[model samples]
Target: MSSNRRIGIIDIGSNSIRLVIYEINSLQAYRVIGEFKQSARLSQRINSDNTLSREDIQSIVAILKQFQRICTANQVEEIRAAATAAIRNAANSQQIISELQEYSGIRVELLSGEDEARIGFLGMIHSLDIPDGILIDIGGGSTEVSLFRQRKLVRSVSFPFGAVNTTRRFSADGDFSEEKLLSIRQMVREAIGGERWITEHPGLPMIGLGGTIRSLCKINQKKHKYSLPLTHNYPMSAEDMAELMSWLPSLPAEKRKKVDGLSKDRFDIIVPGLTILDTLFKESGCSHYVISGAGLRDGLFQEAYLTDNSAIGMSMPERSARNMLALHSCSPMAHLEQVASSALTLFDALQQTHGYDARARQCLHIAALLYRIGVSMTYYQFSKHSFYMIAHSRLDGLTHRETVLCAAIASYKAKSRVQQLYAQFKDVLLETDIDVIVKLGSLLQLAIAMDSSETQVLPVRSAAVTLDKELDITVQTQNDPSIEYKEIAALNKDFKKIWGLKLTLLDASSFSTN
Candidate 1:
């Protein structure tokens, strides 16, 4: 809520702990300022006993202390710490949590597997460009696969056997025996099978996450002289993966170092990561890994919204917006910005009178951001194109129904297209909420007319929306009543018919600014 400052998320994974500082900006954009990470491997010893050891506790304390200092120095308002895989698996995690709270003054929250996958998918999706693909987030202790069906996540599952876990069972400093490789492959195939990962969906493309895949992407990019591998959009084929896995361990550490894009931190686990991904592709018929720079960190930021609103949380709108943007075929950054500007102008003018809370405001914001996403396809009947795209978009933080509503709101601009274009979503929305969409759509229509130029804002003054007997919206402006009045009159006529209300206007003289 403060300017240039908001909160930080400290994500504790089995292998590492990280602190991220995010700023919620005026355009409703969240930006990262500081990111700090450390390798702790808290889940290292929890395999046999499913419990945290004394060493693990000490390590967590160290990470939390380090993170706290970074958060304090950065003036982070909220420090929400989330522990996954490691703490979730550990028997003594509570003891560790209490100790940290008492001695280190840090609070740690352990999340459910499903929630973790959802959030992790959020971060991963936000960090890259994969309009429609299953997100494969292979971590230290477990692998989370989330399906973005028709551009929306229909299912997600967390499987055991992560990079660190696999390294222990499959990887070796020297050449791993053929027998050892086979055994590891069998184990990975079995672990993945336990969740029926392959059986669920065939021919899915993957957007790979975690340090392992990132390191893999980095190495390949450098081999190709790709300075920025994450943004390069290199498609890693099954054959490419198999070749790399074979070559990874045979090379000594020095030889491995020679390979560009590979991080020193990821040396030990790279082989197993590739093996796991290779197996995933072999069985699931997955094509390639769309390299990702974002994963768990993005998930943690979305958690702030999730923790704040459950069932209907901060995620509902935020996720819906991001999903809409993802589904949009247009240049994601530019188009979403335009929609956000247009929607906010209308929302700000009516937020108070409508008692629009954060959730409603968030929905409006997302709808505005994704309004023209359909333009990415054919501009002809773009509104209809935009609707289906946003509805099925794989945006993090939003649920299915919210996504539909967002898509619907985006399509409200084209009248001949008929607002019935969103009849599909009517089944999912509340009657009251349907009315809200109507109001928002009405406002959008009015705003779009003012900005035929669509150049962000207009010089129109003091817009008032009142429902006295019938809904009455009056725009008091110091402009020629001729152009403004004529345009507004036409807008109000349609607004009254659709919303079942009579609309009115009162304007000041052009010479006298109101």
Candidate 2:
């Protein structure tokens, strides 16, 4: 399998068309290289007879042609294009696809409502660590709701109405009378009422996809001055969503655009979109709404390009951490793995003293694996670069607090430097986290020193806290480990200060004989 491959995914949605190019690395870890989107509003172009107009068909072809050219220029090896809702529901769907293929030289895969729901579920499952939830994606002309348990798709349904056509139907006069709101709410409730599975799963987190959900998350983030700028895994309570929906209708059409975090292009359709979300929230009695940045396009990319499922059993944080290592680290995998193993050994051995939980252990492990990722940029102050990269990259399955802590642990040069970094993200972190970071940071530093030679020869044979408030570690080494001893000696001051234990090193053979 090729280690580096570029694939392009073009999504023909009813409200917009988008093309995203991804660079997939050897480990099947991917990142977006280029993204382009244009709002065509194809749903509004459908005639009363359920067929798209010839002019609209030409418009679709034109957009695809441009996307094809962009893909060609990027040297994309494979291009996967799919159409949903608008083209799939149209009576002349086959004709539209034929013309698009003939003119654009890209075969369009018209995804069915069920297929869209399933693919969206695939994207969500791979990106998020949530074991069970309700997935909702609201496009321009259709809405897909799927229920999953244990990360497997259970039931999915697609509603024929979406933000675009719903707005056209009820708010055509540009007036949201109380009657119109009621009608819209009633219609949404009635549409989803038939799906008993949605109502049965009360209090499960509702994972949302599509533009409307993203916009909602942004608006909330801006409103509260959220500390983290990330949108994925952003959580909003049902009450918060209800509050936003309630306030949105009060604003005049022109005034709504002035609100922060809302895109100018989505101004007209946002209200209807929110209404659909609000309806889903109330109907399902969900505990909270989490935004999923990955959706159908990501799902398509994963299905077509990613073949490695070896990381399936790993936790989300570990899997994502490994991916980051694969993508960015210039160090040998064996060296990194050794460092991580030593860190974990020390963590487990010292459990009786620090008493940190598994979460802290996870952070320590991830930090150990990625501490050297910054070497790819520059060796000088690489820890700082590593801190910047790990803190910024979507380390995927980690919470905001965990991600920050991992960065702090990886970049640990001194207690002072870690403290300075913690000050910046205090909003997401607890004051006590400083202690966790320092302890784990020291452990990581010690772990790196054990493998400073990068030969994985000196392994921690055993570690234990003695009665005199001293940590004694035995290393298994055939040859003299004077360099490793020297590195470990340097950390004694900070380690004792943070852990309240004097550090002692013992050779495995010497300790057994004694």
Candidate 3:
């Protein structure tokens, strides 16, 4: 098998049909290369007899044909297509599948409610490292709620009604009066009330998937003028949801369309979607709401193509750092590994003086691995470029604040530069974080200087703090070690300023002689 493969996944959702192309490397790390989405609102086309209209099925086939061509053009090695509630709940699902296959030459996998819920759970667990939480996926035709403890799926249930269908039933005219809103909430409460497990686990964070939840996250971020724009693990609260629900209905239809971060296509259906989320939030007694960028499509890809499942449930920051290193770094893996090792050695040696925790240590390690990532773009002022990339890229499993800290550490050049960068994101950071960033960044700089040659010649044999309050790092090297020594000498002033300790480097022979 080739070391690299490109796979295409088509998700036939009730509200939309999407094709996402992912390029997978040898290590099983994958990134989305291309995506296309067309809104078909298949649920709205369902007949009174619980069958999708033939016209909609034909439209589905046409979209599949186009997706197939795009996949072929992208040299996609394989395509995995799955149909969720819209087609699965149809009375003539078999006939619809046959026509779609016969026309588009694409085999469609009809996911049962259980399958959809489980797959979505898989996506959530792998993407976020939440140990215990309730997972809610609001789709166009159905909503899947799952509870997991210790990173394993405990129970899952799929509700029959979702955003599109619910809207068609209650607010088809797009005017939500007090009575209509009450009816919508009551129906959602009754549907969720049947599941006793939902209320059993109270105060657990609710991890949300699907388009509706993402829209809510985006709008909140925009409303608050949030510093970080990425949405994978964005967090809100029950109060936040209630605030949006209360505020949105007051806006006239025309005004709602003008709200920033809300897509023009979602104007009519957003209210029903928010209603579903609001009901779930209140029913589950969740304290926090976290948005997941991955959903059924990511779940499908992981189940079908990912060769290494070990990354699942691993330390999220570490996993995210390694993935970024594999996908973006221009340096050799050995060099990056050596830098990380040296930085950690220094961190552990000076832990007593710094009094930092494992979180800061993890940030330092990630920064060491990714500090050179910006070299992929341009070597000129690469540190600034590295800072921008790390700050903005989807470093999954990291809170927005932690992500900024990592970026600050990776691109550390001077205290003034870091303070300037921190100014832009002070809303998300603490005043004390500047002290942490500078200290960790100084350690990273010293580590980089130790590997200035990128030949892995100066591996730290031991690092310690002497009685005189000076940091002494001993290295084992076969070469002359002069290059590393000269580089370390240049950083001594900045290192002392940040660490409050004079710096010293001793070769193995010199240490043994002493």
Q: Per-residue CA lDDT of candidate 1, range 1-514, in tens? A: 3555467888888678888887654334455678888987664567476777777688678778888888888778888888878677667767877887876787888877787788877776544445577777778888887788655667888876777776775654623666766777898777776667555667667778777787787676666564221322346766777778778867765566667778676677667667777777677777666666667777777656434222344443465465434433365464346446545665776666566676566666777767777788888888888777766554444444455566667677544333354443454455566666777777666655554444332334444555453433334443233554456567776776765556554334333311
TM-score of each: 0.59, 0.95, 0.97
lDDT of 1: 0.65
What are the lDDT figures for the candidates, one per model?
0.65, 0.87, 0.87
Q: Write the per-residue lDDT of candidate 3 for residues 299-417, one digit (tens) a residue.
A: 99988887776676757788878887777759989889999999999999998898999888888988898999899889999988898899988787777888899999999888897
Whole-model lDDT, candidate 3? 0.87
By TM-score, the better pick of 1 and 3 is 3
Could you tell me how far off, in angstroms, the CA of residue 285 lies in candidate 1 after the best superposition?
0.4
Q: How far does residue 107 in candidate 1 sit from its true spot (Å)?
A: 1.6
Q: Candidate 1: which stretches are off by over 4 Å?
A: 126-131, 171-175, 227-234, 305-514
Model 1 alpha-carbon miss at residue 113, Å? 2.1
Give every collision pair in model 1: 51-91, 123-298, 151-394, 218-261, 309-313, 319-397, 319-398, 323-395, 339-368, 451-454
